[model samples]
Target: MDVYAANMDRCPVYASFFGAMGCACAIVFTVMGASYGTAKSSGAIFSSGIIRPDRLMQNTLCAIMAQILSIYGLVTSVIISGNLVEKMALHTAFLQLGAGLAVGLCGLAAGFSIGVVGDAGVRASTQQPRLYIGMVLILIFAEVLGLYGVIVSILMLTRSTLGVTDCPY
Candidate 1:
């Protein structure tokens, strides 16, 4: 018999609550970031479009890149949801929470960075086409920040277990 079996009180429905919160965090924070990025970049796109209509497509890439941040959150949330179990362990719940936070916070940061850079980059590049390459490079670097979060979250979630530790059922 496992020592944890004796402490059944330690295992409670709150475990599922934590896991659910994780899912919510993953979705909410990321979407917020993506939305912010999109709004900022879209404004820049319209402003820049007035100057150089021909470069509209190129500037649109900024908004598209911003949107990708939300996808990262979506993926993390789905994975965390899948890991949730009827009789979840506290360890697993914490793991899920960590995974969600890792992705959520990182994605938020990335999205903000992308939005600021995209807004400025798009506007500037419209005047000096030579700056387009630099803007793209910066965007790639900002995008990598979210990717790092996804990788970390995946690693954390992978360690979670769905085993029943002290559930009555």
Candidate 2:
């Protein structure tokens, strides 16, 4: 038998465990990032809103942006989880893990950047409304980082066959 089969015989559950870990990582990390971003920016937004109540709605965009990070993770997790099975291939498991990491880490990073920038931007925009445009541009760039991760994870997942047959490569 092949080396993978031999290993699977020794530890049948490991492959599925890896896939489950991937799903967990994708959801956990992204949620953590979203939470951090929301907490960081919400305080600033509320404080600034008290000064200019009319700007409250606009400032809320920061929290909304932070929440998007969690959505990225949720999407990635759902995709990865779809491939999980009781007897996944080791290679497939690793691929699933990689896919999760790609999106999770990127979303985390984007969330952090969004939080810091959102907090500062909201505060600054309260002083000079023109800064709002610049902040949005920067936020968009930060959000793109998470988008890149999702693209890469999707590409990786496309290669996973779930042990139906050997990998093409």
Provide the lowest-lDDT 10-residue window in model 2: 160-169
Candidate 2, 97: how far from true, in Å? Answer: 0.5
Error of 2 at 154 (Å): 1.0
Kindly report which residue pairs in candidate 1 clash with one another: none
- The models' CA-based lDDT, in order, is 0.87, 0.84
Task: Report each candidate's C-alpha RMSD, comma-separated, in the order given.
Answer: 2.3, 3.3
| Model 2, span 1-169: residue lDDT tens | 9876676654466777888888888888888888888999899899999998999999888889889889888998998888887866777888889888888898889889889998999999998999999989988898888888888888888886644453222
Query: How many collisions per candidate?
Result: 0, 0
TM-score of 1: 0.92
Question: Which TM-score value belongs to model 2?
Answer: 0.90
**Model 2 error, position 117 (Å):** 0.1
